[model samples]
Structures are given as structure tokens and as C-alpha cells.
Target chain A: MISKKLAATAVLALSALLAAGCGSTKDAARPAAGGAGAEAGRAGVVLPLLTSPFWQAYNNYVPRMAKELGVETLPTVNSNSDPAQQVTDINNLVTQGVKGIVVSPLDSAAIVAGLRQAENKGIPVVAVDVAPESGKVFMIVRANNRAYGEKACKHIGDQVKKGKVVQIQGDLASVNGRERSEAFNQCMKANYPDIKVLEIPAEWKSDVAAAKLDGLLNANPDVKGIYLQAGGVYLAPTLQTLKSKGMLRPAGDDKHIVIVSNDGIPQEFDAIRKGEIDATVSQPADAYARYGLFYVKAAMEGKTFRPGPTDHDSEIVKLPNGLLEDQLAAPLVTKENVDDKALWGNSVK
Target chain B: MRRLRELALVPALVALIVLGAFVNENFLSYANIISILGSSAALAMVVLAESLILITGKIDLSLESVVGIAPALGALVVIPAASAGFGLELPTAVGLALIVVVGALVGAFNGFLVVKLRLNAFIVSLAMLIVLRGLLVGATKGKTLFDMPEPFFALATTTFLGIPISVWLAAAAFGVAGFFLRYHRLGRALYAIGGNPAAARAAGIRVDRVLLGVFVVAGALSGLGGLIQTGYVGAINANQGANMIFMVMAAAVVGGIAMDGGRGTMSGALTGVLLLGVVTNLLTLAQVSSFWIQSIQGAIILVALMIARVTTGRAQE
Candidate 1:
């Protein structure tokens, strides 16, 4: 019999381990300047781990942008993609009395309390990359995940006029995951009536993605394209699986899967270079540095911010909380423009 | 009743295949069957490892962490430092050996705490699970490792008579383990110890030693599984084994291994992994709504349990 005690322990252990990784590294907060003008208040910059080149570019740019904006950045903390721990770190920031915070939360819903705490305390917060569920955040500046999905779908639609396509969706719990899944499916349905969509929730796990993709490829050998939501995690396995099946080929090959992936990470760039995959949605790291910091500084200065035409190519819209959100430009990165120096992957070095 | 319970998994397997065939014409395809077996390879080892421990009145929650950390340690040394890795570039042979050593050391550490220190095995392993996970994140700095030599995936990539070598490795592990549990005296003592530790000790079965041995074996299995998993995934992320314990525990318990102690089979555990795999494959094949897939998986497990109980004429536990 499974003991009640064992069950309880199992649950507690899962919660604790799952909760541990988001990072509770409490950096001493910097105080805001007393006077206004360019002397904006000090802010906390919490980004995800810089292990991947995507975040490395952010790690490179955000603080530099903060300095140019005259905001003193606290030593950055890496959330490492655990949502709950991010809450702890943000709460720590709140307690440190930082005048403002710019956080790239791992999950949207899981960071509500952390954002709400900053809101309740009247500290301006700029949620970078992910928007919280219900928080009094001043602004959200993120890559439009829906647009990324649409671009991926359009890329696939361009490659294959009518055929089966697999959407290798990311983790479903996050806002990125949900939006990408919905918009890609919606785009495919609207644009390509003859294209059948098969959904595989690989959850950013390479093996799961590889295995599910293998099964689907085998079941439908003539499948024309694959839209992988997270390229950094999926590219390696996707290539390996395709190569093993003798299906990995450059675009324009008679029999090749027109693979379009999201997140312009270095791995995706390499795949694009090799022509093993067709394209990727480049979510520029500078968008976070520029817009994410701008709104935080504006909110701190007691000023209402509005998006401009030249500001990271973002369009302004009302967030759920009635605050204006700017959905930043996410460009489709193809092998043709893989060497674009303006892209984050090219700029990381 | 127990014998019937052990055999009940066979009909469940057949029924799932039949149901899958009815639902999807591609169900019986060579690719689909190979997909099921391929997916089951590494998981089967973890299931057998957990089964051996549970039957010996213990659990190793860190087995999953072992699966994550051992390969991570290997990768840390082999990958370049500029890429946020150590860049030691240890030879493939050394990396492979290190995987075994990491697993053995971690297992021995867990065994020492539970057996010698007389600490609660559950709590200790739970803590080790967290510590090892942390160590992995620290070691890799949350980077995903993928540049290992081709030999790293030899077991997964190569095939013997059109089946992956991973399937063969898993089979050999199951064969040896199943034979040992069914015939060997040392293996017999494991059940005796788990069934009644005090009685087993009085009867000179060396309960503590057998329990420690089970943990070591479980750890080594986890290491082998780690190699196979690394090969299968083709890359290792920092979060590799994050929620793997849930699957391992679920597989063993669902396969008729009593969570408390003292009963299970290789066939039962293999069936458990395959059933889970098949159900997963079915959901994708049937194009079941994504959100409903998890609920459907849970439902199938419950249905499988009810069938087992009905066939055995008693509650599974």
C-alpha cells in the first residue's frame, strides 16, 4: 500500500525541488536619486541564466542600457527559470527598497505576487519578456509570442503549399508556451486550409521532442514542415533525429521538412547555417534592454509612457491591467539573413 | 492472487495494442512499435532500479538526480570553457568511466546515510535529490550540453538487427535483474529483509547490507540510465531530471510494486513503462486535445489498476 506519509513526502519534495531553482539570490538594492531629470532611481535587473547566447546577449545589453538611461542597476540575479524562486528574489528586491525593478520572469502567473508586492509598495516594475498574471506592473515590453508563432506558420506555409505540419510546442504552463501554441494553430488554420496541424507538446525537453517527432514523422512520412517553438532546446535533437532517418536536408531539397523554429539562440543559428532547419523568429535581446528599462524609468519619474515608431519597432496596446503594453518586433531569421549583424545571435560575441 | 496480479499486465498490454489499432491505422507500424520500445529503454532501467529498492523496503529519490548529474559532470569536463563550460575536454573513455563513478559515489553516499546513520531513507534521499540538482545547476551554470563525441550516443544511435542498442541494453538489465530476484539467495534476502527486517536480521540475512546493496545497484542503474538518457536526448539540459522521480515512482507503484515494500516483477515494471508509453503514443495518434492528454493518462492508469484488481480477485496493494 502507498502510505499517506509517502504521498505527502513525495508532494512536499516535488514542490520544494521545483521551487528551488528560480533563484532567491538577494542583491542589495540601489536607492533612487532624490532629484528627477536624467538622475532616475536605482533599479533591480533580474534576468534568466546567461548560459544560452539568448540570455547572454541580454546579460550584455540590459545593464549597459540601464546605465545609458541613468538608472543604477543592482547586481543582476538569474531566475534560472524557476517561477517561485523568482517571487522570493523579487520580494527580496522589494524589501531592499529599490525604487524600480526590471524582471524577466520565468513564468507569467507564478510571479504575480512578486509583481503585486512591488505594485502595492508603489515601486515601478517593468516585466521584461513575460507579463505577470495580475500585478500592478508599470509596463510590459516583450517579444510578441503570437507574432512569433504566426511568422513560423507563414514560413511553413510558404515552404509547403499543402501538407501535414507538426507544431513542436514548448512548455504549456508559461505564457510563451500557451500563446505560441494558440497563435500557430490559429495561423495555420486561417492561412493554409489544406495543411493539417499535429500538435506535440515536447515541453522543451529534447528527448521528448525527438521521440514525439520521430513517431509523427514515421506515422506521416511525407509530413512537410515542423514549427518548433523553442529552438535552443529542440534544434540539436531535431537535427540528430532527422539525420538518423536520412531526412536532414537543406531547403529546396526535393524531400526535406521545412523546419521553422522560435527563439534565435545560437544553436538555431548554427542549424540555419547548416541549412538543416529553414528559419527562426529572432526575439532581439536589445528590445528588453531598451523598452524594458525605458518604461520602468518613466513610471519611476511619475510620467506616463507611450510607444513611438522608432522605439524597438513595438506597437502599443492595453494590457489586462489597463496599462499600455508594447509588443516588440520579432523578426523571422532565415539562412539568407543568418549573418545579419543586427541580430542578437550575431551580436552576442 | 499474487500470481494472477503479476500476469494481469499481459492482457492490459494486449488490450492497449488492440485499442490503439482500432483508433489509428498506423498503430501496428514498425516505426510505432519501435518508437514504443525506444522510448521505454532508459525509463525501464529506472523502473527496475526503483522496483529493486522498493522491494527491499527503501527508496532512492535521488536516483533521478543521479540520472541528471552524472552525465552533467561528464559534460562539464568535455565541453569548452568559453561556452560557460569547464573545457577540460576529458577523453570519451574517461567521461564514460566518470559517469559510473559519479553514480556509484552518490548511491553509496545515500546508502551510507540510510543504512549506517539510520536516517529515514525517504527524507535523506529527498534532501540529496535537491542537493544534487543544485550541484548540477552550479556545475553547468544552467547551460545545455550537446557537443559530446559521437561515441556518447553509440548505444542510442546504433541498431542491432534494426532495433536500437538501448533496447538491447535494457533487455539485458531486465534479464539479469529478473533472474537474480527469482533465483539468487542474496536477491531472495532482499525481499525477506523488506518483508520483515527484524525477522530477516534474526535469521542471519544481513538486512542492513542487503538494503545498502540495493541502493548501490539502484544508483548504478541510474548511472547507466543516465548514459542511455543522454544518448537518447542527444543533449543534456540543467533541468534534465527535474520531475523524473514522479515518473519512476509512478511506474514502479503502478506496475504492482507495493510502495511500502516486498513485491514486484520485471515484467510488471516493463509493462508499466510500455503502458505509459503506449498511452502517450495513443494520445498523439488520436489527436486528443493537448490539455486533456494528462487527464487521459491518469485515467488509463486508474483503469489499468481496476483491471488488475478484478483479475486478481483482490486489491492490488
Candidate 2:
């Protein structure tokens, strides 16, 4: 009888937790269906993860861009940063009989199976943010991540001329993280020979970055500059750590650590205004959404394109994997251009 | 003998400190030691939570998720909608209380499933972990909350006697838990239950009630750990507690806690947390190639295990 009573109380608590869990996953996983305009050309978008503000911004833009481009899109399904789940989400979208699909892959190699399944279903897949290691996609919508590293190097190198600088990197196992780290190190070596780059493999985790960075700063307190790979995660912690140590001097101050970062989020803009950080390479979350739908729509229309410049400023380059990637422009945002009405971060809030 | 086993990791920790000093001149500085202690505070709290659950012969993987969702939910109701909060503007104290309450509630639910339903503890907690993680994503809409009230960041920011309060809290938690497990009657009852539930019940111990209480307290501890983590990180993100379970388990198992239950000490677990902390700090100070850090860290952990086997005079089996 006591067990039975306990079971009833358990049911009550489980339902409350499950009730909240049910609402969000349903909103995320449910494909848009039961439309009166069934023939209005529907596409499915599968997000890699929504944990990062960059992805959240891209998620917010999807429906608006789809409407602006005059295409009906199913509400996006978040894979929640699971490669296997991303594949399952794609198969489900194909089963729903959507005409086209847009996906930001969680893994470059694992996503090939999903792309292949979509191909077998005769649904054109537009890959965004991350390109598949090997797959046939209609178009890859992304910024040049290597250039993100190079731009940061130039920004910091121009000012700090000679000293130890730190680069708080993302997960090295990821292609984006590897490319950025390699390019930044190479740029520092070639352009600013006098500067030394100390790298922290932060794995896109803020706490790990902050802790290791604290240790790093302790060892080398006179470090001149810092390049944060992902500002969305690292910015606050980096600033917090620097402030605690009395190292977060303003830009014009003699002891300020000239900071360059990736991801031009609103927080980064505010930091730039306050002179906590100097510049950032906006990863073009808005363009990724706008053009991910734009290309998927073109594919649905049975359109074809060659590798070159498009009406939009982005260039289409054919990869050795027999895939085409439309490299979008990721502008460098500093104090001067931080308030520009054109930057996505400025427009987000 | 058991007390000596708990101190088994002390030699390994000293050796690592010696190695760290050799790697760099600044490695022995007062500032570096304080930084390592402060940063390891959250992990130490989590290790304590997991150790409590382990001591009871039941594992709770959901403690990791509790570390995230508890604090996220608390912050969500108080901050403005611009910060992705619900805009209730609840009192900061209430928000803090809500974090502990949510954690305790999750623990209670897990206890009900495991004890009342006779479900497998592993599967039930694993499922709860996933569910709680999803709830966090949904509650915060995957947006990182930055504009928390000042008190939310207090545990990490406030310092006493030249050390952060977070470090002191973790140390106190371990001390209290260690003393209870060693000397208190109820703490001895936990060992009796975990060693053999049927035998323990035959001895007139209220096994079910005590087990349920442990689960509840473990959950509350994890929630408090989450609160401390938020202050340490300076913000709360949906992925706050992601992958923390592995570290918690590592610290507990390495510290001499038996996975099968009924044998471990708080000192041993504290040693495990310190070992991992010192190794990470040493590698960074040595300027070891970042690519090689993970491999070297794994190797050191294996060596630590071998040392534990020698010190305890028994294999980990």
C-alpha cells in the first residue's frame, strides 16, 4: 500500500517534468503538415544544435527567410548536437514527402549517410554551416572559416607588433576548429614573426576555456593579445577572468589586451563599444539562413548554376569532393562598423 | 586500513605537484594554486554528489543534468524576456531556492522509480538525464542567460581569506560528508544498506527511508553545484553540465570509491578531483602540445589507478 502511494506521487512529478519536455521536443520535431496549400512547395530544415546563440539566430531567421523567398518550409527539427539524430531527422523529413531539405550537419562524415538517404528519396539537400566530408549536396552555404583565423591574426598582429598572444580555440576534432587554429598560427608565423601564439584547446566549452586561460595567464601575465574562436561561448568568461586579474584594460589603455574574436553576436558588439574586445569576424548567421533557403528553393525549381560569382556577392567554388560551396561574406566588425545597420548582430536585437 | 586507503592518492598528487614545478618556474606560485582550487570547486561538488549516490549502491546519471536545468530554470523566471527569461522578475532568493528545490524533486522522482517501481537504476537515471537535458534546452530556448542578478555570481566572485567562497564551500561539503560517512549513525546505516540490503533490513535499519533521503540530498547537492558553476562561468548556458558525468565518475572511481558500492571515503574522492585538477594545470603550464594533452592526461589517470591498486593491496575489481 505504501509502494502504491509512492507510485502515485512519482507519477505526479514525472508528469510535470515530462509535460515540459513533451512541449519543446514536439515543437522541435513536428514537421509542418496538414496544410491546405499542400502543393505550395515545402522544404524541411534540420538544425545541428540550438545551444549556441549563433545557431539560435540562424534558427530565428529560417521561417522569415523562407517566407521572404516565397517557399513553404516545415518548422525546423533540432538534432540537439547528435549526428545520429541528425540522420534520423533527415530520414523523417524525407518520409514526410518534403520537396527539399536544408541541414546543418553535426558531423562531416556521418552526415553522408543522411544525404545519401535524401538523394534516394529524390529530395535535394542543401547543406548549411558545415559541409559534409563526402556527399552530394545541392549547395553548401557557409563562410570561409580559415579566413576567420587569418583576419583575427591580422587584426591583432597590426597592433600588438611583438609579444605573446593567446588563441582560445574550439574543439580541434572539428574541421572548423582545426582550420581556424591552423590558419591563425600560420598567419602569425608569416606576417608577425616576432609574436608568439599560445593555443588553448577549449573544445567550445566556456568553463574549460576560462579555467585553462586562467592558468595560461598566470604563467604569462604580460600577454599582449587574445583571439577567441567563438565569442558566443568564450567572450563573457574571457572578460570575467581578465577583469578578475585586473588585465581587462580598455583598448586605448597601455596595458589593454587587444582581443579579436569570431561570432559577431550582440554581446561582442557591446564589448567592442566598451573597448573590452577590438574586432570580430561575423560568421554570417543571417546569410547562412537566407542563402540556405535561397539555394534549396532554386534546387526545387530544377535550376542549375556554374562555379563563379552570383548576383549576390558570394562566390561558388567546386570542391574536390564534387560538391559546390557558396562561400558567403563574413565581414570584420570593429568599433567603427559595429553600429552598421547592415551587420546581422546589429539587426538581431 | 580503510583510512589509509582514502589517503592513497596523496602520494600521486604530491608527485604531480613536483612534476609541475619542474615543468615551469611559475608553476609553484601562490596564484596558480588558488586558481586551480577555485576552478575545481564545481567539479569537486559534483564529485561529492556522485560519491554520495555511489556509496548507496545506486548510480544517478541525472545529477549532471540537474546541475544545468536547475540553475537555468531559476534564472529564467527572474531575468527579463530579452535575456530569454519569462519576465516574472521573481526575487533572487526565491530563484536560488527554486534551483535546489528542482534538483531535490528530480532526485525524489528517480528514487520513486528505482525503489517503488523496482526499475533498473542505470536505465531510469539515464532516461532522466536525457529528459532533464531536453527540458533545459526547451526552457532557455538554447539561449545563454548573461544578465543574472549579482547574487547569482556571488559564490564565485566573493573571496575570503585570499580564497574564493566556492573553494571554501567545496572543502566544507567534503569535510562534512566525510565526517558523516565515517562517524554518524545514519552514515554507518548507509554503508550497512549498500553492503547488503537484505542483511541491513534484518538488522532493523529503515533501508528504504534512508536510501530515499540520500537520493534527495544528492540531487540537492548537484543543484548547488550547478549554481556554483553558473557563478564560475559568469553565465548560464543550456550545455552547462554536458559531459560532466564522465569527469565526476572518473574522480569518484579514481579516488577509491567502489562502483559496486559500500567502500570509499570523501578524502579519496577529494584526492581524485585534485589529481585531475593538478594534471590539467600542469600540462597547460608545461606548454605541452594541445593535441597531446588528452592522451597524456588519460595515461596519467591509468597510472593513478595502478597506484591505487598497489596502495589498497587489491585490484579495482
Candidate 3:
């Protein structure tokens, strides 16, 4: 018992020392005055995780854009999609005294503490991709998730005009999940009346999605199409399940299910161009990168923008509460247009 | 524990069934029962493994990671070199062999730490859990591997006697484990060592060897569970079995497994697995809000724990 206590105490002491070392190093890293692009100041970005390509794009993009903008970017810290870790990271960034913070919350409601901490600290925050359910943000720069859902619905609807369609949901606690699911169901009912949509809530985990998809496929062998809310997690598993069941092919192969998915990941792009699957709604990486940092800089620089169709060459929408939102339009990328140099998929590899 | 306390689980199961039927008329149908049984296979395996370890007065927190890394290593070997894979492309037989080896190796590592080094089983296994999970993420690069051979999924996709083979795997694991626990010398030694290791050792029982073997069997069962989960999902994901430790432990505890050790029945653990599974499916079929599912699960575990503690005449909490 004494030895075990000593071991635990030693580990705790080591951790405290390491944390203190990190704090001192960050404090010592305030660069000299009048450096080029130094006016942009040092900033911190807290992302969810790098598990999916969609998140990896944002994680890789922010640092690159910060370098171009002449701002000193601290090493991007991810919560690994844990809400508690997100709160800790945000608190650490605040302690580090970053001029601005760009955050993509893992959960809308669970992120209130971190956002409130930033608000208390007077650090400008830009919410990327996902908006916080509570707490104030200087601005939100994201794609229109509802718009992406509608496009997926139309793509699958056009291909399979009268059959069962499976819609695999992401984490429904987030704004993206609710919007995409509701929009798709509504669109299918309004336009493709013959299509019967079966909803399976997979909660952003590939294994969960795969198991549910496998079961659904077993029960309904003739299911015509599948709409994956996010491809970064769902794409590989959905493809694998289909392949095991001998259902993967080109547009008119022996058994082909019209696969319309979200998140234009690099692998999905490869799959699309290879004719293994249909189109994917490409959420703009530029929106996550340049636009996210743009809002942080604007908020820190005391620039105020309002809700409108377009604001200073950027698309803007007036939110219900008169809050301004910079929403980018997503495109349906297929094999025909997979070569677009500007697409995030081409940029990844 | 009394047989009456054990028999009490039947009412809980029936209550879930009754509630499920009231919520959705199709819940009692043949198709939904099959779905429930199929989904419970992996969980049942996990609970069975936990029952062994818990009965031995030890806990293996790394069982969940064992489930993930075991199958990942199995699939990684067969992945063709053309797609940034390891390129071994071993035969299906060799791939399955790799999974058992990895599982045994992990179990041996845990046993060495706990028995040989006399470390706390809980802490050692917890660290092993983190390390193995990290290794999985690094090995797979957080990418799901679907390029595994066709036979890898046969355990889940195939049927015998008109039911999924996966369900039979769970049943067989429990049946063999129960019989072994009741009749085998080494298995009986597990109870004696967990109840009092020093006394068991004085009684000429090889306590450490028996305990180590128990962990090994637990690990292999967990590894098999991982394989079953991979087959059921029809894909191998890096994040497989993440956060599964809590569920396994909860089932064991609810089934009247004493956390302190040396007291739990295979049937009780099995009942816990079934009860939890039915409640979850019932909630999902009832269309309860997604956000409340976690809370509801916690509430069910708490309720079951209280009932078990009251019936067993011990303050488990």
C-alpha cells in the first residue's frame, strides 16, 4: 500500500512539473515587436480530433493559413472529440494568453463551459463547422449543412426514384446532425415520394454505423441507396459492408446501390472517380481554414459584420436571431468533376 | 447469493419485454428478437470474460482494447501491400492465428505485470488499455480496414439452424466457461485464490499460475469478442470497442459479481447482459430521445445494482 501510494504520488508530481514547464515555455515565447505579420498576433485553435479526414483538413489547414497571415500559431490542440478535454484545452489556451481562439466544438451543449471561459477572458472566438448551442461567438464560418443534405437527397432521389433509402446519422447532439437528418427526410418525402427513408442513428462512430448498416442491408436486400451524413467515418465501413455483401460496383453493375455521402474526403474522391460510388457533397476546406481565421482576426481587430447575402466578398446569412453567419455553399462532386484542383480531396494528397 | 436473487433477473427481463411490446408491437416479433440476440453477442462475450476475471478478485480494464487490437492485427496482416498496408497478405488461417497470438501476448503481458511483478491488477490493466488503444490508432492511422478476407466475416454473416453463428459463439463461450468453473480443478482454484490468495497458496494451490491462466482465458475470450464485433460490423475500425469497458463491468456488477472478488455466477452475468441489451433495444425502439440514452442506461445500471446489493445483503456501492 505504501509503495502504491508512492508510485501514484510520483506520477502526479511528474505531471505537475511537465505542465509547469509547458506554461513557462509558452510565456517565454512572446516574439519580439514589429516582426513581419506579427501584427496578427499569436492565436490558438482547439479542434475536436484528427480521426476523420474532414477534421484532419481543418487541423492541417489552420496552421498553414496562420503562417501565411503572419500570425504566430501555437501548436493546434485537439480534444480527441472529448468534451471535457475541450474545456481543458480552451482553459489552457486562455492561460497561455492567445489573442484569439478558433474552436470546433465536439458537442454543442457540452462546450458551453469552454466558450464561457473564452468570453470571460475576452478572447475572440470563431466557431468552425459546428456552432455552439449556448455561449457567444464572435462569428461562425461553416458550410450550409442543410444544403448539403438536400443535395444528397436529390442525388439519391434521382438515381433511385422508388425504393428504400438508408440514412446513417452522425452525432445528433450537434447542429449538423439534426439539420442534415431533418432536411434529408423532408426532401425525400416532398420530392421523392416513392422512396421510403429508414433512419439509423450511428452517432459518428464507424463501427456502430457499420454494424447497423450490415443489419439493415441484411433485412432489406433491395435497398436502392444509402445517404451517409459523413463520409470520413462512414465511407470505408459502408463500402466494406457493401463489398462483403457483393453490392459494390459502378453505376449499372450487377448490384449497385446509389451511394451519396457527405464530407468530400480524399478517399471518397478516389472512390468516386474510380466509379466505385456516386457523388459526395464537398464541404469547403477553405471555409474551415481562411474564413475561420478571418473571423477571429476581425473580432480581435474590432470589426463588426452583419447578416446578409454577401459581406465583403464572403457569403453571409442572417440567422433567426439577427446574428450574422458566414455560410459557404457546398458542391456535389462526382467522377465527372473530380479533377477540380480547388477541391479539398485533390489538396489532401 | 441465493437462487431466489438469481431468479429475480427473470422478472426484469420480462418487464423489459413487456415494456418493449407496449412501445412497439413489432418488438416481440421474431425479427426484433433476432436483432437483439445478434447485437448482444459481443457484449455477452465481454461480460463472460469479465465474470472470470472479476470472480478471481481481479479486473482487466484492457479487455476492451484487447477486443480492438486483436482483430486489427488480424486484418493488418492480410492487407495487401499495394494500399499502404503491411503487405503480409497471409492466408485466412494465419490471420486468425495472429489474432489469438496477439490476445495471448496481451494477456501474458497483463499477467506478468500483476502476478510476476505483484502490481495492482486494475492500474496495470488500465495502463495497458491506454497503450493498446494508442497503438491501434497509430497502426491503422484511424482508418477503418475493410480489405480483410471474405472469411473474416463468416462468423457473423453465416447461419446455423436458422440463426446467426455469432449468437452461437456467445452461447458456447458461456456454456464451456460455466462447466469449467463448476468442475475443473484450476477453475475452482480461481475462486479459492480470489477469496484468499495466501490461504489458497498454503493449501498447495498454484495461485499465481491459476490467476495468470484465468487472465489469459479472459483475454482470449475478449479477443474472440473483438473478432466477433469486427465480423458483425463487417469492417475493422481503429475505434472498435472504445468505451466498452464500462458496459462490461456494469453487466458483471449487475449480475451480482462481487467487485472484491470470488463470488459471481455465469448465469447471473449472462442475465445481466441480456437485461441490459433488452433495455437498450427497448429504449431505441420506443424512440426515446438520443441524448437521453446514456442517462437511461446509467439509471438502469444503478437500479439493478441496488436491487442486487439489497438481495445479496451486501453494500456493493
Candidate 4:
């Protein structure tokens, strides 16, 4: 009788185990089916700085474009502008099983390990706006900043005739800053050799630029031309200071101080029109987002992608030949073209 | 004589106003003054929040992180699809509520370490600061959140009755905070704890609970400040609260809040904020370099602290 009872209890336990297994399978399948039916793929995007208007515009556009593409983009932004956070976000995205990732890295070099970590997990990363220093990402989509710099420099060089040019550089350590400064300096040296370049690091801060400019102005009162790599907000105080010091008006009938800036923010545009600023290179806000999404889509689909050589280290990556080069078609806006409402309206004062 | 020492900030404030007015007619202009008040409002709220924690003889070095995370969470909530996922569409009010709740939760966590675990407030808050900063950086992926609805942006730039909405909100916050600090039983308990923790505990006051409550209140106020700051800038970035801790602490100290705690009035904190704002405005008008502005601000804070210390010492003698 005891042997019979033991056999009966074992049979009952086996049936219970099978039922429990079936129940769990159903539970898991239900969510999987539901998730598939939602028609949305999860993508993670990492940006360098959230507070900047450039990044802000980029963040706003990515999600909107992702929605249109029927993908849900989860943007994980770092407030401290730290690369470690970028690595952590990538790892987290990988663990969460995201379909793809788009990152605007703070330090391109520091994020290589993180990108490798993601790649190890079979997750594809799309470097957006800012390319990573090492590793082959699925794709890199960024504006041709060097070309933009060259164009900006050429425009300023064309306007100025034999004057000391002061270049207000962004953060020297930043990839964007370094590339822009290099391109601008190279173009100035090649095309306008007479224009002496006095490069000062502004650290991409308005206040810092203003202070540095003050010292620069004090030292180089005869400096007549200024090329700023960033937006025009920081240049306002400097210009105001110059105006106060009676250095704004040219000795002759000319715009005395030729101020050229990048990032055609609304205030900059307005200043250009008012003759407070000379010109600004228009960096369309929508372009940052649209390009980011395109790269992300290509990455997720395993399609080969590459940005402009000026924007990325293409030769280092040994990209396949015949890839369409990405270029920033940034139109130079001066007082003459400042009234172009279609493009200029997006500028934030 | 003690009352005079408490009122010492008023004469200095008046003198600053007179000096500023004499220096530049634009200083008294409606637009410039409004701008000053608008900018100060956010910092003032931060100071007020810190003041609450200060009164309880504890410091929250994590305030900057609290400021960053709360607004970020608010942004996450207001994202239309976030509501659908969570099955709740948080309106601005609801979003703000969520921010405060999360802030309170973080504050409670800090309080748990300090009050329950018996850790040093400074060290605990500092750790919390780093953790929250990391979380903010991780959550946002180093990007900023913008494109807030027009109504939300209006909260930052809109003017109500010749005053910016932010300034009005700050005033309301200060009034309420001042009333609570002056009259509420819990407020009194906080002061008592700051004055003498052991004596207060012996007198049947739940010292731990009061300290925790102070942190929670401070966190809630900080959450509100974050919302205001995000609105004011029309964007929420990862560095939203970077370098703000120093300003808040300086304002509190300059306002005559004792470092050892158990002292200071809300009005004094406001005075301190106003003084900083005025100095900044003057420098801007003077077209001073940004580098000099920072140095000058540091100097002003030092001078104010020195003056307060001297006055307090004289009063004691």
C-alpha cells in the first residue's frame, strides 16, 4: 500500500510541473505577441549634452522622426557631459535588448570600450552627429563640420582685407571644436595668409568667451576680424564691448569688425540683420534629427553607412568605396540673405 | 541689539539698490528689473529649499542632482506617449506632483542614511549627489529635452501683473515657507533639533522624524525649483543643476543662516539671492567680462559672509 501511494504522488507532481511550464510559456508568449503587434521597434539614442540648443533640437527631432518611422526611440541623455554615462547607457540598452542605438558621444575615444561592449552583445550602434574615435560603428551620420568651417573661413576671408583675425574657438578638447578650428585655421592659412590667426579657447561658454574676448581685445585692439566657431549668443557681449570702446566702426566706410559665427540661432540672425554681426553659418536643426534617424535605421537594418570624410575618420575605418559622402549644405547667411523666412524662422532668439 | 543684527541685511540691500540705481538708469528700467527678478526666482527657490534643510542643521549637497532629475522626470512624464505606456497622462500639475514625489523619495533615502543609519549628513548627501547625477546622465544619454508645449514654456517667460510668473511663484514659495518656519510645530521642532539634537530628543521630540521631514520638504521645494528652471530655459539638459550647489549655499550663508544651523530667516535668504542678482545685473550693465563676474561674485559672497560673521560676533560680545 505504501509503494502504491509513492508512485501516485510522483505522477501527480509530474503533471503539476508540466502544467506550470505550460502556464509560464503562455504568459511569456502573450507579451511577446502584444509587443510585436504594437508596430514599434525600441531604439536607444545617446547625446553629448542635453542643455545645448543644438542637442536639444536634435533630441526633439529624433523622437518625432522615430515615431514617423514606427519606431520608439528611447533617448538617454547625460547632464554632466561625461562619457562614462554614455558607456553605462549603452550597456543598459544592450541589457534591455534594444534593436539599435544612436549615440552623440562626448569623448569619442572613451566610448570605444562601451561601443565594443554593445557590439559584443550583437547590438548595432549608429554614431550620430559625433563619431566615436575607435571601433567600426554600423554607420556614422554627422554634418561636414570641417567643410562648414572652411566655408565660414572663406566667407570671412573674402570680406576682410589684411586685418588681424581672431578665432574664438569652442572647447579645444571637443571633436567638433578641434575639427572646426583646424579646418578654419587651414583655410585661413592657405587662402588668406596675411590674416594673422589668434586662436583663443572659449570652452564653448558664452561667459568664458566674453571674458577671453575682453582680454584679447585689450591685448589686440587693432584686431578687426572675428570668426566664432559656435553660436552668436556669446559674441554679443564682446561686440557690445567693442562698440563701447569705439572699435566697431571701420576707419573707412566699411563694416569695421567683420564678425562671422556658426549655428544660425534666431538671435544671431537678428544680429546679422542689424549689422551687429556679419554672418552665421546655418546649421538646420531638423537636419540633425533627420540624419540621426536615417543612420539609426540603416544600422538596425545592417546596411553599410558612412558620413562625410570631414566628419568621420573614414580612412581609418576602411569604409567600402563608393559610399555617398555626407555633407552639410550649410548656407551662409549674411545681412543680404537674412530675410529668407523659410530657413531663418527656426532660429531661436 | 540682537534684533539689529538680524536686520543687518536690510540696510545693505537698500544701499545696494541705491548704488545700483545711481550707477545706471537702466538698472531701474522695468525690463531689466523684471529680467533680474525672473533669473533670481529659480536660484531663490533653490536657496529656500536649502534653507529648510539648513534650519535642521543638515546639509544637502545632493540638491544639484535633485534639481536635475526632478525636471527630467517631469519631461519624461509630459512626453505624450509616456502617459499612454504608463496608462496615465500626467498634465503639468500631475507631472509636477510626480516630480515632487520622486524628489521626496530621494530625500527620504538620504534621510534614511543620515537619520536611521546614523551617517553624517554631508557625506550621505554627497554620495546621493553623485548617484543622482549619474542617474540623470544615464537617463538622458547626455542629451537635453526640449520642445516642451507652448503652455509649459509660457510658465518660464510669461509675465503676470508686471512681474514674471517665476518671480511670483518664488514669492509665494517664500511666503509659505516663511510662515511654516515661523509658526508650524514641525518647523519649531526642526529648529530645536538644530539647536540641540540630544536635548530635543530628550524633550520628547522625534528628532529623526523631524530631520527626515526637513529633507523631504527641501526635496519637494527643490523639485519645484527644477521645474521652474527647466521652464525658464525652455529646455532640460543634463547640466541643469551644475555649479548651482555653490550658489545656493553661498546665498544661504550670505543671508545670515548659521553654518552650524538653527538660525536664519527666510527673508534673509531672499535678501541674499537679491544681493547676488543685483551684483550680476550691475556687472552685466558694466559690460564686465564673464571671468571677472565669477571672481567678483565669489568676492561678494566672501565679503558678505565676513560682514555677517563680524556683526554676529559683535552682537555676541
The local lDDT score (0 to 100) that residue A29 gets in candidate 1 is: 30
lDDT of 2 at A328: 89
lDDT of 4 by residue, B187-282 (tens): 788788888999999999999888888788788888878877766555565666777898898878778777787887888888889888777666
Answer with 2 or 4, whichever has the higher lDDT. Answer: 2
| DockQ by candidate, in order | 0.38, 0.53, 0.19, 0.09
Clashes of 4: 14
Which regions in candidate 1 have their CA more than 4 angstroms from the true location? A1-33, A37-39, A48-53, A307-310
Whole-structure CA lDDT of model 4 = 0.70
Candidate 1 falls in which docking quality class? Answer: acceptable
TM-scores, chain B, all models: 0.97, 0.98, 0.95, 0.91
Candidate that would win on lDDT: 2
lDDT of 3 by residue, A32-91 (tens): 224344465677898887666677677778878877765677899878868999999998
Tens digit of lDDT per residue, candidate 3, span B115-202? 9999999999999999999899888766667667877777777878866798998999899888888889877887888799899999
lDDT of 2 at A189: 99
Q: Write the per-residue lDDT of candidate 2 for residues B1-317, one digit (tens) a residue.
A: 76778888887888888988988888889889988998899999989989988888999999999999999989998898887899898999999999999999999999888888889899999999999999998899888999999888888878999898999999999999999999999999888887899999999999888888888998999998999899888889899999999999999999988898888889999999999998888888787787888999999999988877787787673
Q: Is candidate 1 or candidate 3 better by TM-score?
A: 1
TM-score of 1: 0.92
Worst 10 residues of 2 chain B by lDDT: B308-317
Q: What is the DockQ of candidate 2?
A: 0.53
Cα error of candidate 3 at position B67, Å: 1.9
Over A149-207, each residue of candidate 4 has an lDDT whose tens digit, in order, gives 89778877887857788887777677788888899989998999888877666566443
